[model samples]
Target: MTHRRKTLLRAIAPVAALTLALTACGSDDGDDSGDKKNDKSSSESSDTSGSDDGDDATDEPTEEAPANTGDLPLGQAASEEKEIKRGDGTLKAKITADKVDTGENADLTAAGFSADKVKGKYPVYAYFTYEITEQTGEISPGTDLNSTTAVLDAEGKPGSRFIAIGGQPLKGGCPEKDRELEWKKGTKATLCTTFLMDEGKEPTKLAYGMVNPLLWAVK
Candidate 1:
């Protein structure tokens, strides 16, 4: 009876030990799988973060106004079409192209101011208009607009008959002592000028056009 009891006990002990080993092995396998899943999640998170960073770059706009209008040596030297409005003042002028002769000697004359430069030169005047204030002066006999009233030259120089006008080559301010009337709108005057061009710096002749303003000024 005693030997049979010992044999039963030994068999049960061995079986229990085997069961414990198997349970431990299963738990280890589950832990390894969990680690692999964690690695994949980490990799996915890194990829998403990089994508978000890339989107942040290149997320912002570029045009500038013409610098110093009518306050420079050559009208800011703009090759593009531009208008010199009164500073901080709202004065509109309807310019007329009474003459536009573009050849080897292209001459464009209109408005009250006349831009006299060698034809066919770089930085030449393509378009121009002047607001001759309602004043009194002699422009060119037929031209009622005052020549020295307050003229903006092709080089962006603002000239005034006023004595206190500043001495800036590009911009001229009205001197208090000699300021004449501004070239205003509604001046009933005839628009007359000739376009001339020539070889080099000398004006050769009037080659192409001489016209008159259909309707130059609007109040």
Candidate 2:
């Protein structure tokens, strides 16, 4: 070989080796970049799966507790003052059933009621006290005791009610009079109600109010 050609071959050989080394480094960098991209995709997939699991856990239904709606005694009803609303006025009041009487046929006869009026029936008289503790917005304390009160038989139904007019006094000593005077704070009233049930059917309960009534067991 010529001396000039030998020097040129040596220089070209080093240049080719440097070029090969640079190409190998570039290929390695590309591989590392692809691996990093695959890792990121896998991490994103795992995060999405975790988020879906969290949503599923949150979507599960939960149970709620039941409310109490049991019947309460007369004394308990008296102890609990209820807010009564009428005609844009509000009144806080309580009722106490003090006495109950099951009348006889002789007693009915003495009260000027015919035997046919109460024949094959049980007469019931319930005495109660109505009290007003707080009043607001011009509310009246007067309540229709004969209409509001009921004597329930064994079938959980109201019996025939006897409403006396003109403030007549019953033989059982329950007056038919209901007072409607000045209703102020700390005012109270004694009221009575009467009911008649068929013979062999006894009164089991006494209830007051038309809705969400207060209950009392017959003694």
Count clashing residue pairs per candidate: 19, 0
lDDT of 1 by residue, 1-219 (tens): 111101000001111211110000011100122222112110011111111111101100100111121222211222222121222232233333222222232211111111242223211112223343332222211221111011112221221111101111111111111112334445422222211212343321111011110111111
User: How far is 101's C-alpha from truth in model 1 (Å)?
Assistant: 4.5
In candidate 2, how many Å is residue 153 off? Answer: 1.9
How would you encode candidate 2's per-residue C-alpha lDDT over 1-219 as one tens digit per residue? 111101010001111211110000001100112222112210011111111111000011111111113445554545666555543355567876665677754554444444554466555766656687886665433433223455666666455544221122345545534334444578776666555556687876665554345667775
Give lDDT per model, in order: 0.18, 0.42
- Estimated TM-score per prediction? 0.19, 0.55
Worst 10 residues of 1 by lDDT: 21-30
Model 2 / residue 62 / CA error / Å:
42
Cα-based lDDT at residue 11, candidate 1: 8
